[model samples]
Target chain A: MAKMTLEELRKLREEKQEALEKRSIEGKDCRIIIGMGTCGIAAGAKETLSTFLSVLDEEKIKHVAITQTGCMGLCYVEPTVEVILPDMPPVIYGKVDADVARKIVKEHILGKRLVTDHMFDRPAADIIKQDGGR
Target chain B: MHIAITDYVLEVVQNAFEANSTETRVVLQETAEAFAVTVTDNGKGMSEEVMKRVLDPFSTEEGKHPHRKVGLGLSFLNQATELAGGELTLRSEVGVGTTVRFTFDPASIDTPPLGDVVSTFMTLLAHPKAGSLVIERKTETDGYALDRKELIGVLGDLEMSGNLHLLKEYIASQEAALS
Candidate 1:
C-alpha cells in the first residue's frame, strides 16, 4: 500500500465515519485490553495485539473497544489480555499468543463463552463463589 | 534486554502518559549507522532527585503502582545502550516536561534492530492519552508524521476497534514509504 497521506486519511474518515455512526450510540459493550509493558513486549504482545485488531476487523465486530495498558504484574504470563463483555465478569487471559487471542475473540467475545483453559484473574471470573476472593 | 529499539520506545511513551502529559511527540530518525528516538512530553516533569534515580529499576514515581515497586524498562534499555556504546540523554524540569533521546548503534552487535516500529507507534496511540501524542518518523530518504488528535478527529475515537484497525493501516502505509 502507498503511504496514506493526510488527504487519504481524511477520505477514509469520511467513508468509515458513516459506518461508525450506524453502530450503537449507546457505546461499546465489549472491551479488549492488551498489556504492552516491557515484559509483554518481550513475550510477543505486539503480535497478540495485532491479532486482536485483525481478528476483530475480519469478524466485522463492532461496539468493541480495543486498548493497551501497562502490565497487570503478570510478567510470568506476559502477553496478557483482558476482555470485558457485558453481563459477564471481566476476564484476564495470560500467555496469549495469536492463537489464544483468536480464541478469546471467537470463543470468549463472540461466542459469549469464556476460554477457561487460559483464564487468569479467576476470583473475578468466579464471582458466584467469591468469598472476597480470599 | 528488549529485542528491539521500538520496544524501549513503547515503554518510554507509556511513561509519558503516566506523567500526565497533554502533548507528547515521538520522533524516530534512522541513518546508516545509528538510529535515534526523541520523545518530548509536555507533562509534569521530574525532579532532579528523581531524574538521577529514574534508571535505577528500583525507583519509580510513588503512588504510580499500588502493588508494584520496580520499573525495569529504562534500566534494561540502559544496559542495551551501554553495551552498544550508544548515546542516551534525559532532561527534565519539575514543572516543565521531559525529553528523552537515545541513539543506538546498529553497527554494534549488542544493539538490537529497530523492529516493528509501526506497531509500536500504533500501540502508543492505543493509550487513552494518545490523543496528546504525535509521531514523526523519518529515514534518510522518506518520512511521515501522525498526530493522534487528527486521527481521532477523522476516525472518531481511537478506543473503538474499527478506528484502531484503520489507524494501523494508515501508519503501516506511511512506514512502508520510508523504506
Candidate 2:
C-alpha cells in the first residue's frame, strides 16, 4: 500500500463518519425498552438486550430507539420489554431471552406482527381495538 | 438477588445514572487476598438523614415508586458484604457527589461469583441515562481503562445497535488480554 495522502485520508474519515454517525434518535417512532433492574439483570436481561441490539444493527433498522430502564415492577417475569410503535399501544413482553429478543426484532419490528407467546398480557388487544391507537 | 459481583456493581452504579450524573467512574481492583470496587459519581447526593438509614430495606427515596416502599439493592448488598467479612462504605453530600466503595475477601464462600464484567459494563453503556462512564480494571498483574466518550468518538454511536456487537467483542478481547 502507498503512503496515504491528506486528501485521501480526509475522504476516508468523512466516509467513516457518515456511516458510523447514522445514529439519530430524533423523530424515532419505535421504541424497545428493556428492564435493567437488579431482578432483570439477574435473569439474563443483558444477553437479551445484546441480542436485540445486534439484530437491529444487522437488519439496518432505523427510526427505533432502544433503551434500558430500572425495575418495571414485574420482577416475577423479569427481563421484561415494552415495544411501542407509532399506531399501536405499548406491548409488554416478559421472560424474554436471547431467542425471543431476536424474534422480536424480526417478527415484531420487521414483520409488523406480535410475538404473542412472550407477551405479558395478550397484547392489550382490547385497548388497541378501542381506538386503533388513535 | 445478586448472583455475581457484577450484579452488585450494576445495581449500585445505576443509582448514579438515575441521579442525573454527568460523569461516573467505576474502579475494580482485585488480588489474591481481596476484591474491591469503588463507584464515584458527580450526581445529586443524599442528605445525612437519608445516609443514616440508607441500608434499611424498608426505606427508599421519596416518591420513587408509588406502590413500592423499599429499596433493596443497597440493603441486600450491605448484608452480603457484612456476612462475607467485607465492608461497604458510602460517602455523600447534598451538593457534592457520592463515592461508594466495597471490599470483600475473594475466597470467602459468602462472596458471590465474579460474573461477566464485560457484559455488565456493556449493560451500563446501554443505559440511556448513562452519560460518561469510565471503567478502570486492575488485577494483580494486569490493568486497563475504558472511557465511553473516547470509544464513541471512534466508533460513532454506542446506542447504534450495529456497533454494539463489535464494541462488546473489542472490550471482551481487551479484558481477555489482561491477567
Candidate 3:
C-alpha cells in the first residue's frame, strides 16, 4: 500500500471529492461494495478494499465510488465484493484478494468487461434497489 | 434477536481485535425474560469524542480507513438492539480498555431465535494465534465457559486442521446440551 502523508491524504481526498459526492447522491448509478463481516475481514477484505481504493486513485476513475458494507451472508467464500453498473446487472465476486481486486479495477471498472469467473450473479428478484430507477 | 445479537457480538469482537487487543472476554447470560451479553477487551481504547461518534454509522477512525468507509458496525448493533427492545452500552477509556454490553428483552417481536452460538465461539477459538477469545454462557441452572488455551492443550501437537470436523461435532453436541 502507498503511504500518504497528511498533505497527500488530503490531496487524494480532494481529488476524489467529486466522486465521493457523486456516490453520496441519491440517484447515481455506481459500483459500490465492501464486505466487512468478521469472516470477511479474517479472510482479508481490508487489504482487498485498500487495493481497490489505491487502484481507483491511480486510475482516477470518476463517477464511480467504492464503499464498505457488512456481510453479504456468504461466509464460506468471504472477502466478498459486489459491483453494480448503471442499468446493468450487479455482479458479486468472492474470495477477492489484492490481486483479484486489481483485476476487477482494470478489467471491470476500466475495460467495462465483467470478469465471468469471479462474478457472482444474483437472481433478478434479489437485486438491491438503487437510489435511482437504475 | 438471534441474528442481530450474533451479528453485534461478531462486530464488537472484531473491533476489539482491530484495536490491538490481546485478550477479550465475552459473556452471555440468559434468563426467562431477558438475555445479557458483554464483551470486554484490553485494547488501545478510544477517547470520549471517538466514543460519541463510534455509533454514528459515518465516522471512520484513522487505522480503520482500509477496513471501513462508512462506519456502521456499532450503529448497526445499536439498531439491532433497539429493534429488539434491548439496549446497547459502550464504555472506553484511552490506554485503558473498552467494554460493550447488550441487554435484550427475550420476548420482543424483533428478537430472533438464538441460533448456533457455539459455531461462532468455535470460529473464534480456531484463530487463537491472532488473539484469545473467551466465551461464557450462563443460564439459571448451569453455565459453560470455553477457553482456547484449554482446547490447545487438549489437541496437543495434533493439528486442529486434521481434527476440525471432530471438534466441530463435539462443540455442536455441547451447544445442543446447553440449548
Cα RMSD (Å) per model?
9.7, 10.3, 18.3
TM-score (0 to 1) for chain B of model 1 = 0.94
Segments in model 2 whose C-alpha atoms lie over 4 Å from true places: A1-134
- Candidates in order have lDDT scores of 0.83, 0.81, 0.73
Q: Candidate 1: where is the Cα deviation over 4 Å?
A: A17-134
Model-by-model DockQ, in order: 0.43, 0.06, 0.01
Better of 1 and 3 by TM-score: 1
Candidate 1 per-residue C-alpha lDDT over B27-94 given as tens digits, one digit per residue, 9 for 90 to 100: 99988878899999988999989988989989877788888898787888888898897888899998
Superposed model 3: Cα runs more than 4 Å off: A1-134, B128-130, B157-159
Best by DockQ: 1
Q: What is the Cα-based lDDT of residue A46 in candidate 3? A: 88
* lDDT for position B24 in model 3: 90
Q: After TM-score superposition, what is the CA distance of residue B60 in candidate 2 from its true location, in Å? A: 0.2
Cα distance off (Å), candidate 3, residue B19: 1.1
- Model 1 chain B lowest lDDT segment of ten: B153-162
TM-score, predicted candidate 2 vs. hidden true structure? 0.61
State the local distance difference test value for candidate 2.
Answer: 0.81
Rank list by TM-score = 1, 2, 3
Best-fitting candidate, scored by lDDT: 1
What local lDDT does model 1 show for residue B154?
73
